[model samples]
Target: MLTISRTLSLPESELVERFLRADGPGGQHVNRTESAVELRFDVAHSPTLPEAVRERLLARRDRRLTDDGVLVIQGRRFLRPGAQSR
Candidate 1:
């Protein structure tokens, strides 16, 4: 969870997870597994985020989010299959 209220970045908390194929130097692991790097963020419901940040998120016309307002990012950029969850 990134804190736009006070910090430049934050870790994962209320993040939505997505697993997909990745392209990296993991030998056969790359082919047999998913390991790249991509993460999505949901601007809604974030804690203490700046108003401008919230507006930016709400401005995006992404359909990846659900009715509950959660954005999904495909994560495959790393040594594994999960996103960094930042």
Candidate 2:
């Protein structure tokens, strides 16, 4: 389960994750590693989300939303060797 807040939590089944190759530095090695994560969440028919929250999410004009009311999020992770933590 994914905890969004103190009173909100989403089940793991509602979230789908797909690993894909990321386009960035690392030359030839970049194509071999799947560092980019594509996350899909079905907001139209989720049992976890409340009706009001679902409606609000669907009402958004964000481009990440699809016609079927699915939210698509792309996560790109990049790590540099010998890089210091902020």
Clashing residue pairs found in predicted model 2:
none
Q: How well does model 2 score by local distance difference test?
A: 0.89
59-79: candidate 1 lDDT, tens digit per residue? 778776655656666544454
| Residue-level error in angstroms, candidate 2, position 15 | 0.7
Judged by lDDT, which candidate is best?
Answer: 2
Please, what is the TM-score per model?
0.44, 0.85
lDDT tens per residue, model 2, 1-86: 99988989999989999999887875546689887999999999999999999999999998999999999999987778544345
Candidate 1 displacement at residue 11 in angstroms: 2.9
Candidate 1 lDDT trough over 10 residues, lowest sum: 77-86
* Number of clashes found in candidate 2: 0
Q: What is the lDDT of residue 30 in candidate 2?
A: 65
